[model samples]
Target: MFSRAGSSAFRCCRALPPAVFRVSQPVQYRALSSAAADAAAAAAASPRHPARPTFFRRALSFTGGALLFTSLGLIMVLGPAYESAAAILSSPSDAESLSLFTPPDEDAQAKEDFINSHPLTLSLRSDPDFIESRPHMKIPPSWRKHNLTGGTLMGPGKVAVPPFSWSEKSGKNFVQITHVGTDLCGHMGIIHGGFLATMLDEGLARCCFPVLPFNIGMTAKLEINYKAPAMANQYLVLRATTIKVEGRKAWVEGHIETLPTEEGQEPVVLATASALYISPKQASVSIRR
Candidate 1:
């Protein structure tokens, strides 16, 4: 019975299958390796891209990111300058003539007619002080106020010298200048405030020029008061007088008025200014013609 039992146990053990163990990589790891190899091979086969961006591509690009950045840059660069230019060049209102759309010759004829009708007979040319200073009081050689090929600050693209005069009171000198601002404008129908300031600054310096020790003057400070709107394509007069001179500094007062060609309207005060001019003792600057 023992021999039989032992033989049966041996048979049972043989009947059971032997244990199996795996030595190869996992299925998931093998698949991952294969995919990585394929991707690297594909990348190597393709052409390389440029390292730098192109100008036209960047400027004209309509891509979402590109458009957004380009628009932001433009807005940052040109805000006030663009607004001022737009307002200056916009369509003319009723008060303005149709010369912007008219032919050049016709525009000239119209300007001639206006000037002839409202002649500057008593302008700067006829002023006693102006005649006296003609020999030494030269116009700044680089006074390039845009032309018909461009634009200007006076008399329909042609700046002419109007009445100029000077006086002395309590050892202070006073100067008066007259002009017709027919072309310079910021508002469509009215004059530009900046242009008015420009006129005042230049006139103030000029007033001090004749009296300055070196015949050279520079603006240290300028303050303006705009009492009324100065009109474009109309006659204007500016005057500045020296209030006092202490060492290198001088104080000046000036005012601008609109000169009406018609009989009913009196001259209107448009703006006023007070300015300080100074002469540097040691300077190495000179202007060229």
Candidate 2:
């Protein structure tokens, strides 16, 4: 039913290449597919932003750190105290050792009375040389805490009681009276010569200290002469005199003697000593002109 012109146009369209139309359609589809695949790859490769921590999580972290530091601080501060308490309470040997380091208790009135009422003490008190100076019943507390004397030698079975002393007002002379306990003996009954020497050295130094440029001195030389065996568990007397003083130097002589057991009895000399003590040059220099 087509006119001749229409039929001729139809024939021309059919003559166009079917292959060209197919190639054009496939090229468009390939471009659309590649674009969609590229978009998907880009979305996968992008970095994502992490969510922020909540308030409770941040607070918990801070609190945990604070608690750890506080615990460490407490350990640092209280460690020694805890150790001391544990040593004192838990270990018997440690407690006993600590007690040894502690100073002796102050003398009771009865003990004081015994030393105060001694004939030597009374004589010193009545003497004109010591009238201006009061009696001292004990050594310095610091000396009593010494590791050697206080811890080892000054206990119930050794020195037993605090020594009594009297110093002259002019610092020229000093006297000490004390009872040596039975246990202070190197032999079965005789007191140790070293112990006697220690007493003499300390006594002589003390006798001259007040007369020195400073009230402190070190023994530069010490000489001891043992006279007789000093029996233990007996009252003993030490008398020291400052022989000479030249600037920071002092020469002192002293002797240890047995206290007379009865009236009119001559005291037995046990040991004699002489010593030279010198104050520190620095301390002497610091003295006011």
Clashes of each: 4, 0
Compared with the true structure, the alpha-carbon lDDT of candidate 1 equals 0.60
Candidate 1: stretches off by over 4 Å: 1-183, 263-265, 283-289
The superposed Cα distance between candidate 1 and the true structure at residue 15, in angstroms, equals: 99
Best by lDDT: 2
- lDDT by residue for model 1 over 1-289, one digit each (tens)? 4698899999988876654213244666789999999999999999998777787777666576877998999998787557645554453432232122232465545544554345343453344444222211222222223332113433344334323344442325444434444555677767779878877887777677656656567888999999999876566766677788877777888888875678677878899999988887663242220
Models, CA RMSD each: 15.1, 12.8
Task: Give the per-residue lDDT of model 2 (tens digit) for 62-167.
Answer: 9999999999999998986677555534533311331232224553334446666767777777887652221121223433365455446767667765566666
- Looking at candidate 2, what is the lDDT of residue 68? 100
lDDT of 1 at 51: 75
